[model samples]
Target: MTNDQRDPADRPRSWPYAAAAYVFAVVMVGTTLPTPLYGLYQEEIGFSSLMVTVIFAVYAAGVIAVLMVAGGVSDVLGRRPVLLAGLGCAAASALCFLFEGGLPLLFAGRVLSGFSAGLFTGTATVAVMELAPRHRRGRASFAATAANMLGLGCGPLLAGLLAQYAPWPLRLPYLVHLGLAAVATCLTLVLPETVRHAGPRPALRPRRPSVPAGTRSVFIPAALAAFAGFAMFGLFTSVAPSFMAQTLGVHNLAVSGLVVFLTFAASTVGQASLGGVPAERALPLGCFVLVAGLAAIGGSLLATSLALLVAGAVVAGVGQGLLFRAGLSAVSARAPADRRGETTSAFFVVAYLGISLPVVGVGALSLALGLRDAGLVFSACAMVLAGSIGIWLLRAVPRRPRPGA
Candidate 1:
C-alpha cells in the first residue's frame, strides 16, 4: 500500500498524545494549587492582603522571565528534555511549598512554579497537537485546551477539599501535588520524543519574545484580546476568594474553590464551542462576550451579590476560553513549521502578561481603595480594554480565505 493509504494501526499510536496532555494538565494544576491556600498562608504567616498579591505577582514575574529566556529552547533542545526539566522544576516548587514557613519561601515556591509552567505551556500543547491523528486534530486542539482549564480548575478544588477536610490542611495539598509531579516525571520519560535532531543540543541562549513575520498582523489583535481575557482569569484565580470571604461574608474554602472552578470549567466549554466556528470570527465574538462578563463582574462587586459574581465568572470564563483557542489556532495555522514552537511561545507570553500585570494592578488598588471597590475598578478597566480590542479585531482581521484560493 502507498504510505498515505496505509492501515490506521500502522500509524503511530495516539496514547502518547493523551499521556502528554495529562502530564501538561498536571503541571498546569500545580501552578494554581496555591490559590485557595493563599488565605491559609496569610493567616498562618501574618501577612497583609497586599502581600498576597505581591507573592502571586512573583509567580507571574518568574513565568515572564522564563518565557523570555527559555521559551523557545524546546524548539532546539527537543520537547522531551524541556518537558522533563519543567516537571523537575515543578517537583522542586512543590517541595518548597511543603517546607514553606514564611513569605520568602512562598515567593520562591511561586517563582519556581511559574518557571515550570512557562516551560510546559508551549511545549506540551505543540506535542499534543502534533501527535494527534490527522483526522482528529480538531479534537486534539480541544483536548489540549480542556486539559489546561481542567488542570487549573482542579488545582484549587483539590487543594480546597484537602485543606478544609483533611489533616494538616496547609501541608497535605503540596504533598499530594508532589506525588503527582513524581508520576508526571516518569510519564515524561516514557513518552516518545517528537522533535528529531541529530546534532548536539544547542547552547542555551537568551530567549526573546517573538512570532513569525507572516503571523504578526493577525497575532497583534489576537494577543490583545488574550491579554484582557487572561487578566480577568488571573483576577479570579488570585484574588476572588479574598473578595468572597472579606466582602461577601463567604468564608468556606470549598465554596470558594467551586466558584473559581466554575469559571475555568466555563472556559473549557467556550473553547470547545470554537470547533463549530472559524478562528477569525471567534476572536472578535469572544472579546465582546468577555467585555460583557467583565461588566457583570463589576456590577456584582457593587451589589455584593454572590449570584451575580457566579454569573459573571461563568460568562467571563467562557469568553476567555473561546478567545484563547481562537488565538492559538490562528497563530499556529499561520506559523511556519520551523518556527512553530517559538510562535506559540510568543502567544503565551502575551497571554501570561495578561495573567500577571493586571492582577498586580488590582492588588495595588485594593491597598488604596479597599477590596470591593478595587474589584469594581479592576473589572471596569478590563471591560474597557476588552471592548477596545474587540473592535480592533473585528475591523483588522480579514475573513478566512478559501483553501488554495
Candidate 2:
C-alpha cells in the first residue's frame, strides 16, 4: 500500500521520543533530590519532624494544585512549551535549594519541584506516547513510567552518596541536578511539538476531576489501592530518613538513600512483573503483597532492625508498583475513551493525596508519640486499608480479565 494508504501505526517513529523520556527522567530526578538530605536540612535548619512533613507535603500540594488546575494545558499550549516550563520550575527549585536560605527557601523549592512534577507527570507521558511510532507505543508507555520511578529512586541515591562522602552536603546534589535540568531543557527545545494545533492557541484552563457514571465501581477500588501504595512511598520519602537517624542510629546517609531507592527499584520491577499476572487478579494480589510489606515495615520499626526495614521496603515497593500499575490499567480500561484522561487525573489526585496527607498525619503522631511509634501506626493503618481494598476487589471483580483483556 502507498504511504498515505498504509496504517498510521505502521509509520516510522523518530528518535525524539527517546530524548523526551530522558528529559522526563531528569525533571523527576529533581523532584526527589532532597529526600536523603532532609535529615541534613533538619539538623542545619533546626526544624521539627512536623515541619519536615509539611515541607514534603507542600510539594504534593503544588503538584495537586497544578494537576487539578492546569493538567491539560499541554493539549492547549503544546508539549514543548509545557515541558520547558516544567524544566524551568525544576531549575528554579534546584536553585532554591542551592541558595540555602532557610525554611522558606526549602518550602519554596519543594513547591516548585511539585509544580515541575505536576506539569511533567501528565504532559511528558502524553508527549512520549504521542511521539513514539505506533508499533513502539507499548515501549514508550513503559519508558514513561520507568523514567518516573527510576528518576525518583535515583534522586535520594544521588543526594545521599554525595552528601555523605562529598563536600557541600546540602548544595552539591542540587547543583548536579541543575546541570542535568539545563541539559533536559536543551532536549525539550529540540523535541518536535507533539500537539498539532492549526489556528490560534486555545485559552488554557483547569479541567475539573471527573469520574464518569459508568466507571465509578472500578474507579473507587483502583483509586484506593493507588492511595495505599503512594502512602507507603510518602512514608519512605518524607520520614524514613529521620527514622533511620533518630531511632535506628543508622546515620550513613548513603544507606538511607539506598533503602528508598530499593523501594522504587522494586516498584519498577513490580510494574514489569504485572504482565505475568492476569489483569483481573493483579489488583487484589498487589494489595496483599503491599500489606505484607507494610507489616514488615512495622516490625522493623518495633525491632529497630535495619535489615528488616530494607526487606519491607523492597516488598512494599513491589506491591506498590503492582497496585499502582494494575489499578491505573483497570481504571483506564473501564473508563470511556473520551473521559479516560479525566478519570486518570482524578485517580492521580487521590494517589498524590495518599502520598501527602498520610505522611503529615505520621508527622503529627511523631510529635506526640515519637517517630518509631508514629511509623508503626502509619504502617498498621496502611496495611488495613490495603488489605480491605484487596479483599473488596477480589469479591467484586471477576476472576478472569474483563472485556478489554
Candidate 3:
C-alpha cells in the first residue's frame, strides 16, 4: 500500500519510533566494541596479525549467513520478536566476551554479535520507517541510520575508555554492554509491532537473493557503492588498530578507539547532510566522495602519517554514510511492497559480501605484503570500484521516476 493507504493507526508514533531506534542502537554498539581490543587479544592470545583478520572474518561469516537465510524473517514473524531475538544474540555475545576463555570463546562472541547485527541491520531499519508517519519517513531513515553509526561509534569509545582506565580491560566493556542490552531488550518489549494481519508465520527458509529486472539500473550501482564503502569499513574495524599500534606507533587503546569512532561519526554527519539532496543526485555524488576518501586513506598508509590516516577515515566515513543511506533509500523507494523485504535482503547480501570477502583478502595479503602495504592495495582497489560506481550511476541509469509522475 502507498503511504496514504497505510492504516491510520500505523501513523508514526514519534517517541516510540525513537525508542525503537535506541534499542537498535544499543544492539549495534555491541557488535563493534572489540575494535580496539583486538590488539590486546592478539597479545594475550599470542596470535598473528592474519589470525586477527580471520577472527573478524568469522563474525562477518555469521552476519552474511544470517542475512542470506533469515533476513526476511522479521516480515514473516513480527518485528518485535525477531528484534528481541536479536537483542538476545547481543546479550549472549556480551556474555561470551565477558567470560572469554580463549580463541574459541572470542570466536563465539563475534559470531553471536554478527547474528545480532545481521538480524537488526535491515529489520530494525525497516521497522523504524514503518513506525514513522508518512511525512517522517525521511527522519525515520535518518534516525535508524544515525542510531546505527552512533551506537557503533560509541561501542569502541566506551570500550576504549573503560579498557584504558578500568581494572578488567576485557571484562568491563562487555559487562557494560550486557546491562545496556538488558535495558534495550526491556524497552523493545514495549515497541508497537509494525507488521499487520497476524497471519500464521511463514517458514524460515533461505531464498536466493534476487534483483527485479528493471531495478538493476538503480540497484547495481547502489550495491557497488555499498561494497566500496563497506570495504573501507572492513579495513578500519578489523585491521586499522593494529596498523596504528604496530606501524604508526600509537599504542593508546583510547586513541585507537577514538579514530574508529571518528570514522563512524563522519558517516553520521554525511547521512544527515543528505536531507536536501534530490534522490537522483545523492547516489553518484556519494560515490565520488567515497573515492576521494579512499585516496586519502591510501596516502595515509603510504606516508605512515597519523593525521592523514584520520583524515582519510573521516572522508571515507562521510562518503560511506551518504552512499549507503542513499542506496538503501533509493532501492526501498522502487520496490513493490510485497517484495520489499526480499529486495532489501538482496541488497544487504551484496553489501555484506563487500564487508567480508575483501577484508579477508586484506588479511591474506597482509601475511605476504605486510599490513601497511596490504592496506594501500585495498585502498587502490576500493577507489577504482568507487569511481566506476560513480561513473555508471552518472552515465547509464535513469533516475527512479517520481511517485504519481
Question: In candidate 1, what are the lDDT values of residues 1-405, reduced to their tens digit?
Answer: 101222323336777778889898999889989888888888888977678777888888888888888877776777889999889888888889999879888999999999998887777877777667666766776788788899999999998889888998888998999888888888889977666645665566775778877789888888888999889888988998899998888888888888888999999999888876888889889999898788888888888888988999999999998888898888888988767667777888888888888888888888899989988888888888888988888887676799999
Q: What does the lDDT read for residue 313 in candidate 2? A: 98
User: What range of 10 consecutive residues in model 1 has the weakest lDDT sum?
Assistant: 1-10
Top candidate, metric TM-score: 2
lDDT of 2 by residue, 128-222 (tens): 87777777877777778998999999999999999999999999898899889888888888877756656666776688878998999889999
* Candidate closer to the true structure by lDDT (higher is better), 1 or 2: 2
Best-matching candidate per lDDT = 2
The candidate with the higher TM-score, 2 or 3, is 2
Sort every candidate by lDDT, greatest first: 2, 3, 1
Judged by lDDT against the true structure, how good is candidate 2? 0.89
lDDT of 1 at 233: 82
lDDT of 3 by residue, 1-405 (tens): 312223424654577777788898999899899998999998888887778888888888888888888887776677899999999999999999888879999999999999999999988987777777666775777888888999989888888889998889999998888888888888888877777644455566677567887677778888888988887888888888999987889888898899999999999999998887865688888889988888988898778889988998899899998888899888888877677777888888788788778988998999899998998898998999999878878876576899999
Specify the poorest-scoring 10-residue window by lDDT in model 2: 1-10
